[model samples]
Target: MSEQAPLVSVIVPNYNYAASLELCLRALQAQTYAPIELLVVDDHSTDDSVAVARRLGVRVVQTERNMGVAGARNLGVAHAGGEILVFVDSDVAAYPDAVEVAVAMLAADPRLGAVSSIHDPEPLIRDSLVEDYRALQYYYWTASSEGSISFLFPALVAMPRRVYDEIGPFNTQLRETEEVDYGHRLTQRYDMVLTSAVRSRHDHDDRLGKLLRKLYRRGRARVPLYAQRRRFACGFETSSRAGGSLAALAALAALPVAAPLGPAGAMLPAAALAVSIIADLGMYRFVLRRRGPLFLLYFGVVHFVVNVTIAAGVAAGVVRWLFSARFRRLYEPDLHVRPSAAGEAAT
Candidate 1:
């Protein structure tokens, strides 16, 4: 409290999240942090996102085309007037003190490059069991890895303007794994941490197909980044977790192949499933403690399906990487400054 608080700019890169934009903006507006400016970069949403932001009386910028989240965020930074930059996704409603706490953490540590917020186990808006499962899974996954992290949770993160200057803007070519590439670039120089002190509630994917597709794309897209690293990041996504998904997937795949062998062949899939479940035993236990036994059963079933989907995605990505030139070049983009995130019609 002794030094003057730097003006903080909160940038929201949105894509058709009108249902929860009000809550996101309201919670952001109520932040205890001082000297903050809010801007929403609508990514050609075919919804009322711009209208919602306008109704809430916040500055709105529309993209010329759907350039992806990274482009939108870059535009927000262009328009932002704060020394501190905060990125809050449209579906996430940050807690009242989220910004204040995050800023303090950034200021307290001169070596810290960025701070990523932890999400509550519950969703911002209760929609379905799938969302609930995602919220809890993400919450536990992140909460278990608080402090000194390599993965950047772009959903709710803060950084000083100087850090942005040094590291440069996000690689716009990285539509799915931009954060992963950015985090890798960032931690090589300065420290980035995932802390519980900065917390928010994210309205995660609520439908099974929608959730699986997103996870699958992210799973496949990240193969190139991991290929470059030759290893997974140091945080939540671990070798053990990847193994669990693979095991679950192998089990699902072995079902028909082993069916001709009768009960003896069933052992392969059953054993694989058991191994997969055991691999992530801690996550299931965390769910059990929080949601009780009944919900835990549902959680297990849903998670098994999710693991299979992730495994499939990674496999697909691997195949593409081997065969397709464009797929392998998913993360190779020039990191130079580009024009406004929006098209000429940007307002």
Candidate 2:
């Protein structure tokens, strides 16, 4: 604890994640970093999340209605009294050294505005290969020599109190991708660090349906960020390749309507399906190795569905951006700074 800087507040946002939230709370109580206050914000959970927080003796904030993750986090930030704010998901458990490392990283470099800990969790998804691939790709992406991050994950992040002031709070309108939006703004103003030493482990189930939903939301959530011509153009260039493949398949599916090219058009759909299946096999093998055969078969199909749905959503988001000015403006709420102290609370 530094006398110069006020305490660090660790805020965990929860909604019907009682089981996972318990592990997270326990970990916070045992952090190596002292002088920290824990604030658990429950967005009107049906579970006894408030009771659990009370049992732990942490400050509890409750919303009358179910606000999404971003809104809950905003509420927590509003009530936090610490000079440094840390957001840890209810589904994750921070290692004892987690806060210690992040605090040191920010303290040593006055210019570094934010920090995200490495997530080192045991893989639970049935598809081990796909899980490994996702982890590896994320690892490589964040493995910058400068210790600076291009993006922030909501799972675990720490930063100085001044950050929220300059940039803004998590956009209340966003159900997801709020962290990424905030990260872009932070990078523009201050150094955003992805500390390799700080570690946290995510503890939760990633059932096939849940995974698909998450990816679908991710693909959909990226729409607003794509509104800027340069960002949108780059995004479309990549997203189109993924999405166009599926669109091509659907187009080929319509070929049976042509009497002359009936069988040939059918081949197009078959080819598209084959390519997508093979792609998933190769892409997900790294993460799905541990799952049993039955799980693998189901997860493989689920993965494809998720990818296709996300790609489609991205395409839709892009169209909305172009056709609707209101959507484009609202797509990136963090970009449009409104006059409010709530927005000014945490950085």
Candidate 3:
């Protein structure tokens, strides 16, 4: 007699995303992998998300209050009944093979604590410039080398139940970027892989205003995340870009003062700004080639706006971290479970 396949529980945490809930669930139901359980943890959603989950014949766990994504995920894991836990966001549509691929990778390598699918935002990409930019960004991210990753976003991730038990639950206190924190903990002991073999489509925010707001929120989240930790992987790329953008902005701001000094002084700032622009354009040259010159018209403006908003958000986060006791208290000292407790917890 052949052994039965391990159960895989797909946990989805949602809040006010009724429009995409059905599609997300349907995609999971269509997975090639068998012995799967669906758990939808609603975070006090005002919409019809709970009803939709029930109609789909999935288990629905409603939080008493809004606990954010991290909290909702923790609750879902607590109630989950599977040897392998897979997290899928309400706005993500996983490919039929996504779970099978991830599970295979985890089974083949015990050191791999988690695996996340390469998110393709093609479906969400529209004619709008913002949407196009978002799509290209996802494409670039997904194309990255398949190896150990710093973190895995919940959009579509799978890991053995033992990994979760060892790592404990997602920190409920973090309102944003909790995945980064969780990844940091996971990576300390085991590998986290991001593979292009598995795929999923993300219903990304396309509107410029909404996209900017999301960036700002991410920026604000960084403050507390940075405050609590001395260092984090996968931040080098972002920090380098933000640093370059700020340097360019400073050069432009100083242009007026330099103008009063002389041609030489003014030329220095001009040269600095030009270098920044050239670097940015070089970095996004593929985008220009893909979308044509029209993309260039919006590229600079979008880059500047995004960087400025993120800077403002970071500034706000810093202020709050310094003054707000509540913010400081939310930081978790360690996300990893003790070695001695790991064996006990895993069992």
* Top model number, lDDT: 1
Q: What is the lDDT of residue 70 in candidate 1?
A: 87
Please list the C-alpha lDDT of all candidates, in the order they appear. Answer: 0.89, 0.67, 0.75
Worst 10 residues of 2 by lDDT: 338-347
lDDT of 2 by residue, 1-347 (tens): 56564589999988987877878899899987878999998877898877887887877887777778887877888888888899999888888879888888889888888888766525322245445434433443343222655566667888888887678767766666767677777777788766668887665444545655676667666777755634532111243345544654454454565446767656666666666665444434543555456656665554555556767667677777778887667645444354223221222
What's the number of clashes in each of the models? 1, 16, 0
Best by TM-score: 1
Q: What RMSD does each model have against the real structure?
A: 1.7, 5.2, 5.0
Residues 1-347, candidate 1: write the lDDT tens digits.
33588999999999999999999999999998888899999989999999999998999988778989988888888888999999999999999999999999888999999999999999999999999999999888898889898889999999999998788888787788888888888898999999988889998989999999999999999898888679898788989899999999999999999999998999999999999999888889999998899999999999999999999999999998999888776666454334344472446
TM-score of each: 0.96, 0.76, 0.85
Please give the TM-score that candidate 3 achieves against the real structure: 0.85
Residue 241 in model 1: lDDT? 90
Mark the 10 consecutive residues where model 1 has the least summed lDDT.
336-345
What's the residue-level lDDT of 181 in candidate 2?
A: 71
